[model samples]
Each structure stands twice: as C-alpha cells, then as structure tokens.
Target: MATAFYSHPDCLLHEMGPGHPECPERLAAIEDQLIASRIAEAIERESAPLADLADIARVHTRAHIDFIERSAPSEGRAWIDPDTSMNPHTWRAALRAAGAAVAATDAVIDGRYENAFCSVRPPGHHAEPARAMGFCFFNNVAIAARHALEVRGLARVAIVDFDVHHGNGTEAAFAGDERVLMCSFFQHPFYPFSGADNQAPNMVNLPMSARTPGTAVREAIDLVWLPRLEAFKPEMIFISAGFDAHREDDLGNMGLVENDYSWITEQVRRVAERHARGRIVSCLEGGYNLSALGRSVVAHLRALAEI
Candidate 1:
C-alpha cells in the first residue's frame, strides 16, 4: 500500500494573526514541496473528517471539550493565548486537525496504507488536556494515541516528537499512564521549558542547547529514544513532525537541514518496522521559513514513503 496524505480545507482557516511564525502558509509550503518534488502523485490524498467527540474525549476532559466548543468567536478573532486566537472557523479547523490524526492512525493500523502524513495545522503538540497553548486548540497526536489504544485496542503506542519545543501537553496527558511512551527533543532554554523535568519514566526527554546540530540529535536517538522505543514494542508509532529546527527557520537554533529530518524519519521507520509492523502516523507540529520548511518536509516525506 502507498502512504496516505491527510489534509482538510478547514485547516487554512485557523490563522493566528499576520506575521505569526505558525501561519497558514506552512501548509502551502509543504504542498508546494510535494508538488515540486513530484511526491504528491505518489500518495493517496484524503480529506479529513471532523473528529468524533467521543474520540476526542479520550484525551481531553469534558469540561475542556465544552470550553473549546464555546470559545470560538462569533465575529472577530478571540485570543486564547498570547499567540493563539480563534475566529468562527477555528473550532472546525481544530476538529479537522484532530481528525487528521485519527484518520492517519486508522489508515496505518488497519493496513489500508503503508504510512500516513497529516498536513493539518493549528499544530497540537503543546495543547494539554485542560489547556490550549502554543497556537494549539486540541492535542491532536495525544488524541490519536488514546484512540489507537482505547478505540482500536492497541496494547502499546509510542510517540516520537522532534519539535523545536517539547510536547509538554502530550507528556502531561500520558505521563505515568504506562500504556504510552513519549520520546522527544527540544531546545531547552526556549519557550515552555518543562520537558527536562519529565515526571514520567515513559517520557524520554532530551534537551539541547542553542546551535546544537543533527549529530547531537542523532546521538540522543541512539542513546535515549531508541532503547525505550524498542523495549516498549509499540503496536503503533506516532510522530509529532516539526521542521522548525531547520537552520533557516527562526524558531529554534538546532542547525538541522533537510537531510537531518530525512535521516531521523528513516530511523523512526526502522523502529516501526521492527516493533509495530511498519505502522506509523506522523502529524505536523512546527515549521517556518517557507523554502527550508518545504524542502525539509519533502525530504521527510520521501524517507517515509521510501521514494
């Protein structure tokens, strides 16, 4: 089976403001790369459905869920956080973003696709069960992980987050749960500095200093993430894919280039093959710098699709 590409038109409607780093253009950039690289022709493209409330409730509290449904502004944009805002369309976009993850999870796990990539936005790695921050309204990957376990009945699941910032919300949701394993690396001195103090043994947190390169990130993969992932033997693998660490992106200083992301995906795929029957669902998290972000994502998708 070919890799599946999950996206929705509503995704572009969830804009924060003018000049925000995590803007609507990030999705356009990736789409441009897929077209330019001719990668778009190779995968199955599908529109994402609005996530079921029951499926979303698996990761979020009922109160939090009700709050978001009511938080969407009727007219002008309403601020949820300093960088996060919502208009009338934002609620539907959040559901589609979360839905993209669920659809990808289903495609990979049910053998309908070899792997899946979600290009929806209002990126969700930083959204907690009860809080929304970092431009995220819902914890998409966390929602998918819980659904894969509770709905699809997978015994174990693994999440690999290589975002510029830690998936603090995800770590909080699944921490100490034992059913899920989270391995992540992010800029330590950056925003939302909490991954370093991982309260859960299942959370393999790696913090990098400014200007750290792929070599250091790779070392972390070899030393910390891989061992735990292999030991967990996840029935399904999920990735919070973020390209902001690329050298051209102003978000974080990891000095990573296109090849670094490709290399990491290769290793992630290998682990999935060994442990999870090659089942993987990757959700978009962060990527700025349009050109670099585009190329980096193409490299990542190429590796995932084995193209």
Candidate 2:
C-alpha cells in the first residue's frame, strides 16, 4: 500500500484568531502544495474520524477532555491560556487531530500501508497530558505511540521529533516509560523550554541554540540519536515532523533549508528500514510561514513517499 495521508476538514475549523500565526489557512497551504507538487495524487487520503473518548483517554485524562469540551465559548472565544484558546470548533478539531494519529498508527502497524503521515493540526507536540498550551490540545503523537504499544502490541517504538520547539507534552506523557524511546532535536531557549531536563531513560534529547545550521543537527543525530536508536532496536518508528525550523520560516531563529528536512527524513528512513520494516507514522506538529511550510513539508513527504 502507498503511504497513507490522514487529515480532516474540521482541523481547519479550529480557529485561534484572525491574526494568529496558527490560522486555519495553514491546512489550506499544505493541501495546495501537495496538490500542486503532485504529492496528493501519489498517496491514499482519509478524512480523519472524530476520536472517541477511549482513544484520547490513552493520552489525555477524562477530566481534561471534559474540561476542553465544556470550555468552548458560546459566542466569542475561551482562553485555555494566553497561548491557547478555544472557539466552538476547537474541541472537535482537536479530537480529529488526535484521531488522525490513531488512524495513522493503525495503518502503519496493520500492514494496511507501508507508512502514514497525519496532516491534521493545531500542532500537537507541545500539549502536555494535563495541560493545553502552545497551540496544542491532545498530545496527538504521544497518543499514537501509546496506542501502538498498548493496543497494537508493539514492544518498543521510537519517536523522532525535529520540531523547532521541544515536545514537552509527549515527553510528559511517556516519560519514565521504557516501552517507548524518543530522540528529538529542537532549539533550546525557545518557547516552552524544557527538554534539557528530560526525565525518561529512553529519551535522547538534543537541545541546540537558535539559528543552528544543518551541519550541527547532523552531528547531533550522528553522535546522539543513531547510537541510542541502534541500541534500542525499536519495533516501530514515528516522526513528530515540524517544518518551522526551515531557513525561510520566521517562527524560530533556525536556518535550516528544505534539503535539511529531507536529509533528516532520509536518516530516519534508514533507521525504519533497518529496524522497523520501513514502518513509520509521522504527524505534523508545527510550521508556519506558508511558503516555507509548503516547501519543507513537500521535501519531508518526498522522503517519506520515496519519490
């Protein structure tokens, strides 16, 4: 089977604000690029299902889900925090975002597809288990990893996050749990700065400074991620793929180009091939700046699709 593309129209309905960086247009930009680049025709696409409470409960608490559902504003908007807010559609969109992950995980693990990529958003990596912040609500990728381990019966899985910011929520959910191994590289001293003190034994955290180049990232992957991944021998691989670290993106001070995304994706592909039967389920986490997001995601998906 081809690489599965999982997304939903409701994901676009989760509007933060009119002038917010995480606007609804973000999804449209990605879809436009994939269609224009012919990437859309080359894969299978599925509209994301609304995630059940049980599926989300795999990562988020029942109380949290209840709070988010009830937190929707009747007229205007409700602020979850200074950074995160809920419009009426935010709750449904977050459910579909997490649902896409669950579906992608099933596709990769069940031989339904060679691999999968979740294109839904409110960018889930920064969402903690008990807290919602940084434009995320449900820790979608973390839920996927847990589902693979708990429901799909995978013994070990590795999550490789190369977002501009750390996946603190994912780490919070899976920390101290040896079933999942995580290796991530993100700009330090950035938003939600926390990876430097990662508490998990299987967690390999690489914290770089702002504007760090591709060379520096390659060094960290070579010196850090690969060794730990080889030793762990993960049965499955997941990517918290974020393109905001691209040189053209203004969100972070990083200077990576589209080729940088492809380079990292290629390296991760090798690991999946060698250790996990080329099975990878990637979920989108962050990337603003329409042009950069489009190009970088195209480059990333090209690597995933082997085209």
Number of the top-ranking candidate, with lDDT as the measure: 1
Give TM per candidate.
Answer: 0.98, 0.97
What are the per-residue Cα lDDT tens digits for candidate 1 across 2-65?
8999999899988877888878888998898899999899989989999999888988899999
Cα deviation in Å at residue 295, candidate 1? 1.0
Residue pair clashes in candidate 1: none
Model 2: how far residue 243 lies from native, Å: 1.1
Residue-wise lDDT of candidate 2 within 1-307, one digit each (tens)? Answer: 6888899989988888877888888888888899899878888988888888888888888888888888988767899999789998888889899889898888787888888888887788988878889988888889888888998999999999999999999899888888889899888898887989735697899989988998889888999999899888889998999888887778898888899899889988888889998899999888899988888888888898899
All candidates: CA RMSD (Å): 0.9, 1.1
- Candidate of highest TM-score: 1
- Candidate 1 lDDT at 211 equals 93
Which regions of candidate 2 fall more than 4 Å away from where they truly are? none
